[model samples]
Target: MKLIIISGRSGSGKSTALQALEDVGFYCIDNLPAPLLPDLVNQILRDPDHPNKLAVSIDARNQHSNLKQFPDIYKRLRETRRLDCEVIYLDSSETTLLQRYSATRRKHPLSDDSQGLQQAISYEKQLLEPVSDLAAIRIDTTRLSLYELRDSIKLRVARRQEQELSLQFESFGYKHGIPLDVDFTFDVRCLPNPYWVPELRGYTGQEQPVIEFLEQQPEVQQMLADITGFLEKWLPLFEKNNRSYITVGIGCTGGQHRSVFLSERLAGHFRATMDNVQIRHRELN
Candidate 1:
């Protein structure tokens, strides 16, 4: 069975992700006990009409003692032959999480009589580190609207069926912090600065003007060629090692101009060569 374990902080949109997976025909479960995962897998395996796809959410409500055993359980599930397991970890900034809780007036799973919302958020992040560390895909939902988050869940999780490598390209600005979840990151800060031009400053890299400016730069082409060539040569090695996903990050001074241009271009090049290539602009989104 193809299994997807969706886990994250309380307000990071785990419920939304589970719903999206269900919409796409995954037999989805939420807040499953940490230890019961293997039993569930075994049950699915023993069934005559085996389920083709399964998704489960490991919530923060799980006992602290049980949470500590997650590492061993996650490792065992991954090693199981019949279980094609992929971990999707969702996260958001503390400020955003706080805002979400305040707006919705929802109590955090870890929050109680003694703990405040902020403390609970911090404590939950610490608590969830074991599963988060094993995550094949870490999605930072700090900027995503509910609609966009659902779309991302459908696009990323639903697309990877079984033993398939999903490739993603993310563009970010150096001004913002680097993305925590990526296999490779290429900083194209040396590329032509389209933001310097008054006409193109207002436009983003997806627009024709910014694209044209970056395309005209010889060094930008070289950087793209080198990065693409290296990935083309090494990607098969990762596949051989049983890797399921690879994220290529491209960054510039600002995500709006050069980095975004390169990301779109690189994704365009690889889309012809592979089935599951995706691109995300961190600053723009």
Candidate 2:
């Protein structure tokens, strides 16, 4: 059986992620008690009619003592021979979470007469630290739209095969702030700048003119080769460590040219040998 644990602070789109998994045929449960997890798994195993794909959402709504015991419970769940368990933690910036609450007019679960929304938001992070520390995948939803989040859950979680590693290459602009989810970040601002060229300034790296301009620069090719070689040497080690997913971030000045070009190149190179490789350009999206 495959078990996916969805967790995070409230208003971080945990419901959307659970729904996405449900849509893909996962038998999903929301706000399950942490201590009851072992019983749930045993029940599912005993029943042949029960779905093999199980997803459960565990969060601050549960009792404090139950949340504290999550690590020990999780350790035992992972030891179950027939079970494949993965935890996906979703989070957003404090400012974004505050804005979301203000826009929607929804009361936070932790807020009360003594606690304001901001205070509740801050406290919830501390309460959920035990679960967050064990997460295999962490997603920052500060900038992602609902559709984007749903697509991410579908592609990155639901579609991944058991025991397979999913690799993602994302390109972003340095000025916009680095992506919080990437495991590795490479800055390519030192390479040639297509934004300075008069004609290429109007096009992105995915376009033919910008692509042609970047292709001619020896510095760009050399950087791509070096980055590729580094990943080739170390990626197998990550796989050996049982990592389910890895994200590589490539950044340039505007995320329009160099970063996009190299991200596409790297994805192409890896896709030839790997079954699951995905690329996304943050600024372009």
> Which of the numbered candidates is closest to the native, going by highest lDDT?
2
Candidate number of the best TM-score: 2
Model 2 Cα lDDT, one tens digit per residue, 1-285: 999999999999999999999999999999999999999999899997879899999999999999999999999999997899999999999999999999999999999999999999999999999999999988889889888999999999999998788999999999999988899999999998988888779899899998899899999999999999999999999999999999999999888899999999999999999998998899999
Worst 10 residues of 1 by lDDT: 156-165
Clashes of each: 0, 0
In terms of lDDT, the poorest run of 10 residues in model 2 is 194-203
RMSD of each: 1.7, 0.9
Q: How many clashing residue pairs, candidate 2?
A: 0
Q: What TM-score, over all chains together, does every model reach?
A: 0.94, 0.98
Q: Model 1, 55-149: lDDT tens per residue?
A: 99996899988889999998899899867887899999999999999999988878889999999999999999988988888888887888888
